[model samples]
Target: MSHYYDEHDLSRFGDMGRNAPDLWDKFNDWYQATFQEGSLTGREKALIALGVAHALQCPYCIDAWSQECLEKGSNLDQMTEAVHIAAAIRGGAALVHGVQMRKRNAQLSM
Candidate 1:
């Protein structure tokens, strides 16, 4: 089954009515104005977006960013490297929290 959603649809899949279009539009406009020229080309930003999407664990965003990254000339190896970086960060985050869990367990006896 397929449902249609436009900017006005505002379904809460992820980025929905949480932000007003007026505000979102302004933010997006500013982003374009700030990063779409002079420095940090669209291709560079696409790779960054891909890395961020991986970190955020958003499948939809990941799909979009990966496509954009490829279109923007990021090779397969670069894309895979970005994903690996995200994986390492996520794993390190989980592993680092083990210290807190162990500490809490140790203190429970006291």
Candidate 2:
């Protein structure tokens, strides 16, 4: 079945370079540097990217990172765990903000 987001869009990601070569070059450089071997292994970085992509709700990133994680040798369990970690952090952040709402409610009631 077709969806609003075509899988083909992923292939067109680099087309942005056509309009703005300088910014695109900088972005590409940053992206390449980010994925290079740092303190984290490539597989670990892929897993982290998968988690952040899921949390950000970017379908393109999610799709790309899912494949990347697999290609980087992350197993299903590890990828799933990374997604779950993102979910937990997102949930906790939402819940924590409720404290401010609760405090405002108390002040308004008084």
Model 1 TM-score is 0.69
Off by over 4 Å in 1: 1-19, 34-41
Model 2 root mean square deviation, Cα atoms: 2.0
**Alpha-carbon shift of residue 23 in model 1 (angstroms):** 1.2
User: Per-residue alpha-carbon lDDT of model 2 for 28-64, expressed as tens digits?
Assistant: 9999999998999999999999999999999999999
**Ten residues in sequence with the least summed lDDT for candidate 1:** 5-14
| Residue lDDT tens for model 1, 26-46 | 776786686474578888778
Q: Give the Cα error of residue 105 in candidate 1, in Å.
A: 2.7
The parts of candidate 2 lying over 4 Å away from their true place are 1-4
- What's the number of clashes in each of the models? 0, 0
- Total clashes, candidate 1? 0
Report the Cα lDDT for residue 95, model 2. Answer: 100
